[model samples]
Target: MMLGLKTLLLFGLGGQELLLIALIVLLLFGGAKIPELMRGMGKGVKSFKEGMKEVDEVKKDIENEVKKDEE
Candidate 1:
């Protein structure tokens, strides 16, 4: 069975639980900083994705080199 993102991240947390968590975050960070935090998170995720792509390209190159050697 393939577990979806909600199942993996939320782990059965209901709407009320999500709302409570959001409220806590709002209180701790305040509304003004939320946008900045989200922006930083977006940048971080973008960087991580780019890094993963580079790693995959390197792995493919290595595999191709091995195949060339074997042939």
Candidate 2:
């Protein structure tokens, strides 16, 4: 099963595809920027999570305020 998968992957990329991707990344970001790029991605995900949590908090607060106002 695994051998079949590896064969498919090898056929897909072969040597030339791998070389092309490597050259593109090297030209675009050079060596030093890869980690920075990944770090920024991590921070973006974190900020998204925090923003979602804040939204959830505000929603709950609004619900409570409405309940209190009704009472």
Q: In lDDT terms, which candidate is top?
A: 1
Pairs of residues clashing in candidate 2: none
Per-model TM-score on C-alpha atoms: 0.85, 0.58
Q: Give the CA lDDT, 0 to 100, for residue 47 in model 1.
A: 100
* Candidate 1: tens digits of C-alpha lDDT, residues 1-68: 13433774568777778688889999999999999998998899789989999999999999999999
Which digits, one per residue and each the tens of the lDDT, describe model 2 over residues 1-71? 46645875777866677678778988999889978987998899789989999999999999999999999
For all candidates in order, the CA lDDT equals: 0.86, 0.85
Please give the RMSD of candidate 2 to the true structure.
Answer: 8.3
Instruction: Please report how far candidate 2 places residue 24 from its true position, in Å.
Output: 4.1
- The candidate maximizing TM-score is 1
Worst 10 residues of 1 by lDDT: 1-10
